[model samples]
Target: MFRDTQSSWMSTLRHDVPASLVVFLIAVPLSLGIAMASGAPLAAGLIAAVVGGVVAGALGGSAVQVSGPAAGLSLVVVDLVHTYGWRATCMITLLAGAVQLLLGVFKAARAALAVSPAVIHGMLAAVGVIIALAQLHVVLGGSPQKSAVANVLELPGQIADLHGPKVAIGILTITVLAVWTRLPRVFRAVPAPLAALAAAAGTAWAFGWDVTRVDLSGSFTEWGFPVLPQGDWHLIVASVLLVALLAGCESLLCSVAVDGMHGGRRVDLDQELTGQGVANMVAGALGGLPVAGVIVRSTANVQAGARTRWAAILHGVWVLVFAVGFGWSITLIPLEALAALLVFIGVQMVNLGHIRKVHGHGEVPVYVVTMAAVILLGLAEGVLAGLALAVLLALRRLTWVTVRKRDDRDGRTRVTISGSLTFLGVPRLTHELRTIPYGAAVDLDLNIDFMDNGAFEAIHSWRLDHERMGGTVVIDELHDEWYALAASGARTLPAKSPLKAPDRWWLPWAQRRRGAEPVTVPPDGVSECLVTAGTREYHRSTAPLVKPIFTELARKQQPSHLFITCADSRIMPSLITASGPGDLFTVRNIGNLVPRRGSEPHDDSVVAAIEYATQVLGVRTITVCGHSGCGAMAGVLSGGVRAGSLPGLRRWLRHGNHSLATFIETEGDRLHAGALDVLCRVNVQQQLENLRTYRKVDEQVREGKLELVGLFFDIGSARVHLVPPLRPTLCVKPFDRPVVAGEE
Candidate 1:
């Protein structure tokens, strides 16, 4: 009895029409500019845009992503055209489309992400530099050289002999684009590219300047079919593959990025690849340039409220209608204006923000080297060089290890080795063990992941030599039992290693058996896992360092604030408050909740704790803190645990009923925005109000003898936000207190 439901047709038309118009307007100038930059006919750019929008939009996985000729692939197109001629380049594009289609059919689209981002961005940046260099000659009304170095060498001559009218138009276009973004919002509704084109074209006409313009007299009527490339068979195949992989990577990455913009549906990368391949094939057959997902139009589509693929298809229709009916107007746009647009775009591709972001991750060397190689050598060479460097960096990080040696309290030496253990670490292991006294007892802690036979034998031989001189050598494996397995004559271990948790505590509370012996730090040297490492650390360092602070705290604890919070291990009151020892008397429970007076069973524990904290401890302030992503708030919101499953726990959650009710009454309609986060804040405020139901707390508050506050801690951000209560608002607000020092 499954029935299909669909949204109203009116709703579809309402959203898609306006979004289509906006994307269409933005695509017109960019398509032409990219085409001009790639040395393809102006009609080829329009053809690609139309095919990308209609074909890809209808068949692609991403709903809002728009496709067109991309500036990122301009250099690739230019190189192919120069080597194979325009018609043969179209055949290469066709072959690339076939390759992409095969790749999509095989479901290998997601593998495209295996390439390093440093290499990708570097490749793009190099293309940017190349485009800017070549387009600079075009802007100056001079023919561009084959390579970037030649362009650089002849750039001074072009500048010296710059055509006055063309140079004026180019400068005016660049100037308009640079300043257009800073104009008033009302004046900027037109896309910057269109505005720059209009300004340059208008100036050329008004001043009677002789500037080159786009000529598309018989483009559609005289378009011819593509011919096969006459180059070496292997080179032709390689050229096809280069186009396919580059276009595929660009389109896939753009789709993934666009997916983050909406919550409607995730991009199906394989389907998107198939759609792009199909679009490229169609465009190639029509003598158009290679098509890919262009971020400019895609972003515009999303921002303009596109709800479905209809907007993308409609955009293509609009472009087709305009090109067929009003194609004459396009010829009026000055060539220098288009060159200036490409130059601006090319400069922007070498993004300072992107460079800074990758620089922080220590990938600047790869990015810089790739960019240099691309400008000096070529696109494929630069990417391969960057990928090689990135691989080396990854391998170095994976194989890194650290070894620490310290003398124990009882005249024995302890060695802690961590990370992967292989033959590479054998020399360091041998040198360190030999430094220990010949007759001294030794404690070896192997906190390693994997161990090769060479590392095992080095340690085994060292232990034997020490024991021959009457020295006791004890070895403990903190993680995997590498030594034990080796001793049992197993040369190779299982590929899947054991799960190792932090040894903050030796054993779980529920797992401890009766009569289990207490784990102690060895008198001679401590060599154990993380569970006992804290106790050992305390014995070795912390206890002595904090002796004075603890000695004073032991005498008296007169805390200024009585902090009540959830039992979540991450919510540490002292850590947040920057308190050393006993600055706050604390109470931890499931939800940081306070029940109404005489309302619930099993509420005595919380009531008594508050009573003792207030009446006995006489603390000045009482703070109830809640946190984001709280299990208790989420449980109450979602009913995650059944009352039958944990009756006792369910009874305790009844205290949160008022908080839930308050949230529904105040902000229920906006729950989809952030339900758990809003509930966490509301619960903190509700508990503060509940504290007033207690006569003692109310009396103290009224008499100016106490303060009540609510706090919210965001786990991911590590920020504490003050919650404003609605009822019986406190005289002293949470923000009234100065922020904790050094938190951020």
Candidate 2:
């Protein structure tokens, strides 16, 4: 325990202390600037900073997030101050903090995140414009008017008659801030705002210019209790909710961003909200501006190597110490410099990156509407307008549908309907269906993801009416069978269920198009043949996709594997191996057998193919694949009783005599597996041995120039298992474990 404590103290001294100093430098100037922009006493900004950092940092869920007076709340704070006196505004802040505390206790933090990001971005951008317009007046050596419109109307006059020293100082401050990032790394080690403010203060002091200085004299000593405002109860309650919600949201959003900046424990948003609430209550009681998480300071804290909440808490302590001990030093700095800083920050809040992000998601309209409404109307009114528009846009997208009608080459009308089939699209759907003439053959393709009862009834009624008019209608659902399910009185699958795999051309015809009927049959009476239908499908679909590949391999065929397997139609070599065209040179037989060299009943056909594949084609690997429930193996176990009638088949059963002898010798008494299954696996090993009996195959095997592989396909489980050479134990376990040719 002692060693752990010692290590923690060492870490705090090494990492947290330096990070705290950096955050302190950043928070002090921003707090002061935001306080000035909000028309509150500069001391109120400092007070909020101290309370936010110390209180919120100690209690908040995020380890490294820094909290303080944020500029995002400046416009709202200034409005509250103007309407209700400063004391009443403090009371509102207090009430807002209590409301936040209740909300955090109830764990409603995640619900706030459901609000559209476009709405939040628009609100922040609009607030930025308001802050910039108001601060521009102070930068121009004039007091700002009541509204953003009034500020714009009086901007031309203020520019014409600028106070010399104040304008020069503000311009110098903005210039230093704008160019500070481009300076050398060593110089930029000092925070840009700190450097700008210090430069402005130094120049002003040296020149002895007559400028407005920050007056914090008696600011800390003159604290009083908050007073309730005299106003309509509805407006007052609305104001409290606004402050609580806005401050809570901004703080929570900053915590989320801070989580991405560092590799640390994720922030508990509910706890973070509670911490912000406590900090705000403290700040309001102490006659400070509203407190919330500030992203700039938090980013600085993380980048400066803060590893814990101590950095944020210590930074706040430093601010409080400086405010008490170095109060006289602040009087030397010009107020115009702080206003210039506010202008720079406010301009930055309208980020182009945010606009591009929202635009990509097709929420640009919501962002623009929200921004315009806030600028023209009030903040609350603008937010409501944005929310309303966002809800409407969502509804429109949810009920969106498309209907395309065309005449196919076979004289059948092809109508494809897609998207969600809600009642909102019923009018357009019925209109399109009505356009189809009576007695016309129609292929109705429903490519919809979801369908409602209204849409199903519309299509069903149309089909009935068309069929009664002597027209044939075939309904094919390309996606989920929503219409067919509704038609058969079965409960349709929910739209939000797990998605099914899309139809692929490689799948069997019966599985690919489940409910699709034959559009047209061939006149030659071969229409029932799957091969004929598959050829037609290839010509229409698969041929186009593989044509380029076929073109490349037109002159020659160079396959990698010589795959020899049973003549089982259930096993597709390419599908099992995940290979494409020209990948496998296949040889299929009744038993997947190999005739031994110089043996009776020798098959020259199998020998010729093996020699050609190994010597001429230069195929490296020859795989002998067998399968479960093989009829040849079953006949072998029955002593050729099934093949007794046919002389040719009885002679062919001689190839498996060696496999039968091996199975009986090793596994006849063991009842672990069925006799037929044991014989089938042994047959694969016997075939591999028969191949080695040839001089060419033996020589290549000895030289390690040729590889012989055995494969067993379990038709029931649809799994492929590898079989080792010369081993009597066929391993039927999963591929993760080792397996032998004859092990079960």
Candidate 3:
């Protein structure tokens, strides 16, 4: 525990210190500016920023998110302050914090995610417009009007009679903030807002401009408590709820956005809400504005390499220290410069990137309506309008249907209906059904569910009318039997298993499509399985790809090599070698063992295949492939095949007696693990020697007419290992070969 603590502290010192400094620089200007725009004391913004960092950071769910005053809530705060005064507005903020705490306690924060993204973006855009309009007045050396409309109408006059020095300072601040990003790399480490404010301060001092500056009064010596409102109780309560919901929604949304920007830990929405609520309560009780998760500071913290929440907490400590010790330095910043900063931030809140994204999802109408209504009417009115449109669009998708009509080759009209069949889809279904010819045979397929009475009656009556005109109507259901159940007057039916597709293992790669219909399998009989495999491969998957290869193989076949292997069903010579038609002539037998040329018990099948491949086809190579887990080898080791159940069968296995003798001579009486596997490999070498008993095979090996190869396949590891020859006289590759089976 002690070691872990020391490591954590060292990590924080390395990463969090620099990030905290960057966030502190960003938070100072934004905190003061948002408070000024909201018609509150400048100190309130700083107080909220401090409380948000220290209190929320210590208990928040996100590891690196920085919390502070946000510009998106400026419109609401301004209206509340104007109606109830700053003291009463602080009381409303406190009440809202209580409500948020209750919501977090009940774990209701996840419900806020269901709100439409279009509506959320529209709300932020509306707030941005309001902030921009109001701060523009302040930048022009005039106070804002009562509402957004009043401020807009009076903006023309304020611009025409703009005060000279303050307007110049505001423009200088906006210019510096805009161009800071395009500056050289060295200048980027310093926060752009701090750089802009410093330039504004320097310019004002040099020119002796009489611009308004920040007023903190006595700082920490004069802290004020919140006062209760005297308005109607219900109205006050509703206002509190709105404030809490908006603040909670904005904070949770910022956390979600920040979660995507990092690869580390993810944020917990419930715990983050509780932290914001607790921070708001502390800030409001001390005469501060409402607090939220601010994206600007959070993004800056992430970019600056913060690894923990200690950065956010330390940033708050720095702000509080700066406010108490160096209060005079903050007072030197001109209010017009701060307002210019707010105007820039407000403009950015209406993001064009987000607008393009929502437009792609066909939610642009909801975004546009909400934004316009908020700007022209009010925030609540705009949000409600957007929400209503989102609900209507969702309902339209739930009952959507598609009806497709086609003419079949068998003199029938086919109609396929998909998606939910409800009352809303009846009109479209009826119109499509009437378009079919009256006396034509109909095959209707329903790949749908949820059939209502209105749709059922329309389809049933159409089918009956067509049948009465000397036409046959055949109905086939794919997904559900809704139409049949309703026609038979049965509300319920027994559940049946879904139909399984017939095996299509013979299809080649190019001939198969995913999810195709299965061909029917015939009953088991002598030639039934052969007919099924042959027909399915030719008609379904084979003929289209390589018909010429099969056509040429039909007349005369010439193969390069003869492959001899065990009769294990898992082994496929063509699949392993990647060889197509007329590549390898194959001979499969139990254990892949070869009998001597003049042995007492001779196998005519093996001798004849070797003669046909080598002498007739002029094959150059003969490969003997043995596999692990050979039942023949296991039976030889266990003496299971030596029983006298059948004399003919026992005589046939005499060729494998040499392999059993090798296993007993090399290995002792104790059979360890993998003893049978070791014997299976030695059996391949024994069989290769036995193949030379034929005078033709021995002469070909010396005359170079054929190359003899021995292969051992390990089924468990899916690898093929070459068996070394007992003597150096064999003509083959000198190196041991190990190949990953099935790999080309």
TM-score of each: 0.70, 0.69, 0.68
Q: How well is each residue in 1-744 modelled by candidate 1, as lDDT tens digits? A: 123224545656888889999999889999999999898889989998899999999988899999989888889898888888888988889889889999998999999988877787888888888888888898999988899999999999999997999998999999999999999989888888989999998989899889898999888998789999996999888889999999999999889879878656788999999998998899899989898987778988888888889899999999999999999999899998999988898898898987998899998988998999989999889888998999998876656666778776668777777667778778877887788888888777776778888888988888889999989977877567889989889766746264354344234433443222234356566644645644664543345447778876774677777889999988878766666566678889998988889987657877897898889888888889999988888778866464448777788888898888898998864567588899999999999999999999999988988888788988898788888777664465345332432221
Question: Which residue pairs of candidate 3 clash?
Answer: none
Q: What does candidate 2's lDDT look like per residue over 498-553, in tens digits? A: 22334575666666764333334556654466776567556533564587899878
Candidate 1 segments exceeding 4 Å error = 1-11, 405-414, 425-443, 462-474, 494-499, 502-744
**RMSD for each of the candidates:** 15.1, 13.1, 16.4
Q: Which stretches of candidate 3 lie over 4 Å from their true place?
A: 404-416, 439-449, 466-480, 492-744
The global C-alpha lDDT for each of the candidates, from Candidate 1 onward, is 0.83, 0.85, 0.82
Instruction: Please count the clashing residue pairs in each candidate, in the order shown.
Output: 2, 6, 0
Question: Which candidate, 1 or 3, has the higher lDDT?
Answer: 1
Query: Sorted by lDDT, highest first, which candidate order results?
Result: 2, 1, 3
Which residue window of length 10 is worst by lDDT in model 3? Answer: 735-744
On lDDT, the candidate that comes out on top is 2
Candidates 2 and 3 compared: the better one by TM-score is 2
How far in Å is the alpha carbon of 700 misplaced in model 3? Answer: 48
